[model samples]
Target: MWKKPLKPVTKKAVKTKLILLYEDIVCDGTEGCKRHKLVGKKYFGGLYEGSERNEDLWLEVQQYIYDNYDTEYLKNVYIAGDGAPWSVAGCRVLEKSKFVLDKYHLGKYIYKATTHLDDSQQAAKEFIYGAINERDFDGVMRLLQKCYASTDQEYKKKEVTECARYIKNNWLGIMVRIDDGGAVWGCSAEGHISHVLSARESSRPMGWSKKGVDWISHLRVLTRNEQKIIDLMEYQDKKQRKKNRIECEDQLIQDVQKRKSSRNEEVLRKAIPGLEKKQFSWMRSIINAGGIIA
Candidate 1:
């Protein structure tokens, strides 16, 4: 899962989108791992779009897992992420869940730590990765120290120190990868975020209102879950019609008793025309929510 930022409609606006995704991987549990992609469930949200708090969101994540899998029988559930607090929170929410520092982020820090090495950077990364693979925390720190000492630049030294601290803080997650061996594949959360959220929400040069962000994020999740957009619109139309009918029932009865032709009754006779009229500005807004409308 990633907290992807959205383009604000106004200069003063600050909006963010959080996408939670979980997929089941069936690995052979062998040294030579082979796996295939499976359907995954996704949840999307904006910071202020709903009444749910951060804790509430995580509890819902727990519930999502429970609803999908048999938690009692599952031996290991790995939560791989970029060491963000929200990403790591899954460990606390889920039973038997282990946090694994994602390869993308771990590589990022290692790259920063070795940036001053120039020609020898790749060699240094190899050694650092080797140390991680061997579950040697001290060896990893020693290599980072070497990178630090090799550089006279204060900025490079800071980068090296920061990398060291990041590794130290996420040491347990790194160890989980080492201990799990080939059974665990590195995290693809970034790619998932790009595909699910960023491609529609932020990849373009456009601005979004908070409600637009919320609606499209949800629509994207539904699309990912194999729900057709047309079908969704139809369902929403039905729901709206049902609500309108309930709200108008008493008024319609009063109008009938008075022998009056009710406008509410006329509206109830008609289907939602938003789908039929292509010129409706609001209909265009809904269709273009994800920037897919042409």
Candidate 2:
């Protein structure tokens, strides 16, 4: 359940203030389908698009953290996710967080690069892996360039370029893992998404609505972080007692329902326009007021 913390790297720019790592995928129930397709496979359902579901989930989680925790909780934040646009978008949306590419996705690119290489080239593959594992960005790029340049038109240079570009764009994040002494490896998020959605995908049909996937996935995240639920319940119980002292049963019930359904920042902004003074000060206060618990 616990992983090592990433070590800070030597960088001129101030590191991100908070790091959020997550991954997501659509699940269609199938046992062992070659592709994500199956005969009569029912689509597992959820919100928006499956990708958007992932984004929204991250946003909700981030908001919760920001609301309940100290702003200084994280000096520099790193968000890690797979290559999916939803994951990428979530990272991009964070005001002060840096997005790190998932190492597993980078591995996929490496495998693709060596797919046609000979068994004798296992050493080359190992070398590439070492560079990535060490978070040696320059080393990785050098190796890739050499691999591409030496090949006799066997591999597409463009493919190599695309992969290299990904690594370059995400170089800092990838190095964070390496520089941190491997403390911040992103396998947790990858494992989370895989464990949550893999079995469901293998068995269910495809083309599910995004909302269905999100609700189920959110449940999975909730189950995994049971302490969060307990805290919310406790907070809600306290709030209920306070409300009971001053309100009737029907009004209390309605208030609870409203708190439950309308805990988001935007909703609160509209409800109490004055709270929007600082970036998210009102939002944080509302969350601290146990809006999230409901």
Candidate 3:
């Protein structure tokens, strides 16, 4: 019988680390654009809230765009976002960046429409995709409107109507590749938010301060940049070492001062002969006289 070899098993402690998700957009003919490259910027909070956050995010995004992409690519910058007004406003800042509504948000409305429909649910689903893919923005609106008008039930009508208006308001954004000269790609914001950010930041029974959220998100983003995270950890370690060194020096100084004081007292005692004797003699005389401390 041949002896069997056992494989080694390793146990490691659970360490908390920031997680990041990014879209891998293929780049071409540039040093920065080597291949299918991952591009991402870390951010926390809504762009609509607070001051200058949206502006700052755009600065990072635009810089990334310019570096890895051609000038013509800049002219056809496809900015994919959801139905948020802030997403719209953020797109406007980039002169050439065209705003495209995320298809995933629209898909939610499609699913919502299916639930309320009493019949022909499959047909409704197919038609929604067909219209959107055909770049027939008005067709989509019209189809949803027809869904609304045909439904006599008040509740269904309201749901269908809202769905229609969602497509209507985001008309330009809905059909970016077909309407404007933009890239053909899917938006991965859903995965990015849920799996990437929420998994680390918000998916637990915990809360975070604004600055805390921002700092952690930044750590995630830096890790994606490769070797940057190591540099950051090393830098922090150096700071901690320096702090410990300063504290040790401070303690040594205090210890030295105490030793010097004790040595000076001994030296004084030795230098001043009969000092202890005189002190004891005064106390003894007072005790002998039976004088009270007062």
| TM-score ranking, high to low | 1, 3, 2
> Which one is best on lDDT?
1
Across 1-294, the per-residue lDDT of candidate 3 in tens digits comes to 000011121242111222122434657467776445445643323211233655665556666656756767444556676666555665656557677777778788777866656678778889988998898777887778777767678878777877887878887877675566444576667565665456666576555554565666566556545448778889999999999999999999999977876666566557767756855676445544544456
lDDT by residue for model 2 over 141-253, one digit each (tens)?
Answer: 89888768865764467667777887777676676666664336434443433454544432343433344544554444455444366675788899999888767877888
Kindly list the per-residue Cα lDDT of model 1 for residues 21-98, writing each as its tens digit.
556555645667675454465665545333345556667667877888888887876777778776677677767878
Q: Write down the lDDT of every candidate, Cα atoms only.
A: 0.74, 0.55, 0.61
Q: What is candidate 2's CA lDDT for residue 186? A: 35
Candidate 3 regions with alpha-carbon error over 4 angstroms? 1-48, 67-75, 133-138, 150-155, 180-182, 227-294
Candidate 2 segments whose C-alpha is farther than 4 A from its true place: 1-56, 92-96, 129-139, 149-159, 181-183, 202-207, 222-294
Highest TM-score model number: 1
Total backbone collisions for each predicted model: 0, 29, 0
lDDT of 3 at 32: 79
Candidate 3: count of backbone clashes, pairs at least 3 residues apart or interchain: 0
Q: How high is the lDDT of residue 293 in model 3?
A: 54
> How high is each candidate's TM-score?
0.67, 0.49, 0.58
